[model samples]
Target: MVRISGEAVELANEGSLPAQEVPQTSITRSQAVKLYISHALSTWNARGYEFATILFTASAYPDTLVAAAIRMTIVYFAMILFSSVVGRWVQKSPNRLRTLLATIFVNRASVLAGAFFWLLILSQEDLIGSEGRFSLAKNDTLKHILFVVAMSFGIIERLSASGNLISMERDWVVTVAAPSGRPYDLTHLNAVMRRIDLVCKLISPILISVVISALDSVRIGVVYTALTSMVSIPIEAISARRVWDDNPSLRVPKEVPPEGETPPLQSGTMSWRTQLRQYLHDSKMYFSTTVWIPSMALAMLYFNVITWRATFITYLINVGYSLNTITIARTIGSLFEISSTVATPRGVEYLGKSYRSVPQDEHESEVGLVSGEDSQSVRDTRTLVGLQRFGLWGFTWQVFNTAPVVVALFAITAPRVQDGGINVFASRMVDRAADYTLPAPPVGWSIVLFSFLAISRFGVWIYDLTTQQLTQTLVPSHQRSSFAGVETSMMNIVQLFAGGAAIAYPKTDQFVYLASASFVVVVLSWLMYASWVYRQRGHLVHWEKLGQGLFVGGR
Candidate 1:
């Protein structure tokens, strides 16, 4: 038995529905709005602080790009290694709200301490002997240690938060919304969340630029971080309590069945290995879809090449542009990203609606339903529908996957001429110059490039959302965290190799070419695998059906 909004109700038996309707346990619209606001605030503050810290560290370090890369690698590696344990703990915790709050506190505290230490180090430069100060500054081992500590705390916080969100969303879907016969509308919800995220991205760059320009010290950035953290901490704490109050079962620990008693079928008590095996067996299509990881890794390596080739800040300075100019450009790009994200779901919805309007014969073909005795028109309609769906998913994957490659290509091929002691380029076509420098490209070119990058970013977000929905569909509630951990761990393993490769050959054209070729091979392999899976499964590998089941229907 459990309490929902002060009403006593028995837990629904697995695979059965009671004759009487279960009172909705889903969060009210008001509660959801509040949760969204709180989450947005916390995420924005956390991400802003992180961005500021990275920028500050880059400014302080000599090889800024390499330092950033190494730090990011360390963070991802830590997440990969620790996520499984963290996930299991979250699932088993008696008081999940407390657990989540504690993690957030620790994460913020660690970052705050690191910021203070950084300021302390800078302040003590004159007090320390020249040799000692030089050693501290030159090696930067202390800074690295600080970053590792901060990032470790961040990993725990993020893992806890992810588990909490999934649990809440699951409860809302399975218990509340479905029973209440309401449309889930996941796409719309996602769009709302993403819109908030985009706003944060748009604002963060401007804020950082203003701070950096005004104070000319990284410490000021820390102030913003601290202030935001203070606000976010309380809001998160309040939200956690509200969640617990609304859903007491979430706060209770799972009880093991006594000896000689039959355990609940839905209990997620399988060994980690067994769970992983089962998940893989059930999600063969998903696994096939992820064959793009190696290609993604190669793309990441290509990205590093472009990033390190010429630091964006250095390039801007060399091009006779102010820091503010770069910030403005970035802010505009972020706006574009926001717009694209906001628009994409509408576009997809429109396409879905349009596709549904075909003749019944065509619709049956689109959905891969055909009889041996079907007419020629029906078969042709089916073929067209199949092609449409295939093209949609394929285009989506390519758009998301090709971003880094496009950036790399732009880095290598953008026209350039000599200017301000560095290579520069103009917007229009130009003759090859002895010195690699050119006049600033047309404003339109900059806008186009920025928009392209923004669209790519949006595509990545969509891809992530799609995969997350798929995972939520495939994994049971109790096993969600563990499954997420395993998936993240696998991805990190691939990224580790990619990061290592990039670090080993930081500046090499051959490496980029090799990576690109590897990406092409992996992509081709993925396509073949997808085709095979489609033939076997009779449908393209996608989350659309799952989405429909979860959102459109109670199931």
Candidate 2:
């Protein structure tokens, strides 16, 4: 049996009522707490590897923007190539626990291998050079070869890590939270998971950057990452195993084929053309769904080169900013993002309360639905309406909040007369600012730039959480990871373009162009999201009422 409720479809057994009619097993408070803790540990370990890789690129090749671009582009390309494959594998896997553990093992092993390769590169560098700079000896060929090998390992690591993320964040969290007879658990779980991610993102980079900058040796940073990742493997595994053992529902595979599509034939028996056709059909399936708008909007945000990312960090280092200074500014931005995670749940709760307080007949009359519908379906409709409203609200805020970043870039990079003021110390750079021994920005202007960037993260994360939850709540179970993997690939494709832009304008003075281009993409993303909201307005709560409730109410 199938039931439709305001853009979402629920399926059940042929003889049974809709799945929403069945009594769900409620999770104990202890079990909920354990899930949150396990998710935090696993997310922290995953983000450790992610941030460590960024630090590796930014620190190891501080003076070479082109080298950093190449390495980052390679990682993005690897995700584009392998995310879908990993997604399909996870969808077909019978044992989620074994699949998750094996994926983590591969990710950890690749990190260790990359570290070994980086050690080789460090060995080839001359130790008697300038502080915090890696000057190679006459053997350029050997160094290039070692760089390629390290990036190869990086590709493998990113592939497996991307797979792990899709499995956990996209699939398992929803599966575990939805059937627990609690509507708010999914939102709370997403918020806490993202909070843990932000926390790790803030700490790992700072620690790695401080180690490399203070010690003046990239080798030490590499060793520290390798050792910590080695220790974290067992801990992450154990936490994940506990969650899996306690939730028997997670073990049962969800394999409902998508409506209107035939099941795929055996891979070994299909011809190459048949496989190609199947792949195209799958692509169309994703694009045809309502979820694609949010997916594409989020992906468009990645075509940004001027954000607080690896390329921008590399640019800051090249422009004479100290690594310690860069990490401190990023930590400030992360704090705002962490707060956004907290704010998101409150916003969700506010919307839920407002929607639930509406009279059923009034809601049904406004939307042209029957008055005597099942109460569960009515609840489901209200939930969908709330998600859609919040998604639109978040997007609207993001559009306005991101505009300041472009202005900040233009102000910081403007050509002006050299002023005699407090000089910020430079850590890594070749072209020191004229009239100053070290390349440093005027202290006041530097703060403004960092402040604009930091504040923008508040809106960015609110939108991120809303869009992610909307996708999680709406997408079908069988296609969750596959859809998420494609979504990841799309975002990386845009990021690849951003990396290419950095390669084209590989100097600090030419950063304004990248910033302008990124803002234009942000506007375009807002338009796409706004259009989706307009199309779904019929099923959503009244826009004026929702706006008044969110903006005007003291509650």
Candidate 3:
């Protein structure tokens, strides 16, 4: 017997398998409200602080591009290396909320430490001297020491921030939504959370840009960043605490024992070798799960280099597109992404409801059509069916929309390079009056690419939200963090490859090969995802029915 919102639903029994009970749990409207507020403030502060610190680092260093690259490398490496550690820690923790707070404190504290060290280095003005036309610091040893310490703390901050996000977004959100037993609530929450993130993504960088523009000294920007981080600590902490206390579900997670705790390996502590072995074991388990299909699909999408990425912006610039044109185009793309976040919940609900209306007899015959115990009860309830059905819909929709991007990528022709300092061009283009005049020549082609890219953002985010919800709902509670951590690392690993692709063909004229390679990668990703979707077709709502219901019936 299971109790959800005071209604009882008897679960069917499986032969030879022990049954698990569903507890009576509910998430009230007030709890949901507070959770949203807390999540919003916490995410905004973290993202803003991160963007500000990156901006400060870029401005502080003598070689801007190198600094940016190094910072990105450090951040991604930290995420890849430590995300699993945090996941395992959270997975085995007695108090998950405490773990969340621990991450937040460490993240904020590290920001402060990094900023302080940077300030020390920047304040040594007398030690700074000119090297050719550029101002270079002369106290090599002290400067190097400070720089290294600052970056080291930066690594710590990134590690903790990743953990914090894993806790709040990946772990807690699912935990909180579970009690309601409604996929719509889960979809709604996921959409709102993503909306917050996208909002920050759109606004935070621009604010950092403003701070960089207004401040005469890089040191001032560093100070401002430190202060902002300091302020966030209390706000994030207090709000997170309130959310935890208000929602009991968020506080209690089933504690799984730390891996490699056998008598031989567990003499109170394990060695590094044992830890590595344990991580590998966990990775193997994560990759073997049914959810890994969509996880890998999502990760592979990051491999496609066709979007409004920085590389694309540079390509446009090298091909004679004005910075204003690129900025406006990217902003338009972002707006479309934001719209997806807004629309995802409705999309999920629409599909969910339509799928629910299909006769049980229609779905019952094919339930458990997938070769796993997981899909056995897919039609036992509306919730179970909705999970995979909408996920497939969103996944297939995005892949269809990506067709335009493939065309856009192949549409781009080899560019004739333009000679100018990127920094000078960026600065002048930002303040320069907008040229409403129609773009001529190569710039026109770039616009076509940007237009298709903008349109695709809507589908991309819809797919993202659906896949996220699917992962959250399908994976068991205790394993969610571990799976998510490893999944994040996988995404970053693929991203590193994407970055390598850019490095391999960096010249403007070489973009054609890059584009060609990207197209191939996109096709590969689509094949993988499409094949999986096809395999699950028997377990899913008919595409013709779903389409007619969504667009024609407006249900």
lDDT on C-alpha atoms for all candidate structures: 0.47, 0.68, 0.64
Which residue pairs in candidate 3 have backbone atoms (N, alpha carbon, C) closer than 3 angstroms, thus clashing? none
lDDT of 2 by residue, 1-555 (tens): 011234433311111213453234444566566666655655665666677666666555666656766777777877776676677677666577887888889988998999998876775544324343454563667877888998998888878877887778876677666531155366777887788878876776667767877987777888988897788787778877887777766666555455556335455666757756655655675686667898899999988775777668866775557977986888788899899899886776566544442444542332211123455444444555555666667666666666766676666666322445432222123345534444455577677778867887787788788888767766666677777777887888898888778778766667778888888988888888877766665443454565467573554
TM-score order of candidates, top first:
2, 3, 1
Kindly report the root-mean-square deviation of model 3 from the true structure over all alpha carbons: 7.0
Clashing residue pairs in candidate 1 (N, C-alpha, C atoms within 3 angstroms): 365-382, 417-437, 417-438, 418-437, 423-436, 424-437, 424-438, 426-441, 427-441
Residue-wise lDDT of candidate 1 within 318-380, one digit each (tens)? Answer: 444556666665666566557655654444443233233233453232221212333422332
Residue-level lDDT for 479 in candidate 3: 68
Rank by lDDT, descending?
2, 3, 1
Model 1 TM-score relative to the real fold: 0.64
Count of clashes in candidate 2: 0
Say which prediction, candidate 1 or candidate 3, comes out ahead on lDDT.
3
Give candidate 3's TM-score.
0.81
TM-score: the better of candidates 2 and 3 = 2
Model 3 gets an lDDT of 0.64
Write one digit per residue (lDDT tens) for candidate 3, span 154-217.
8887777777777876667766663223543666778878888888777876776677678656
Model 1: how far residue 486 lies from native, Å: 2.4
- Give lDDT for model 1: 0.47
Alpha-carbon TM-score of each model against the true structure: 0.64, 0.83, 0.81
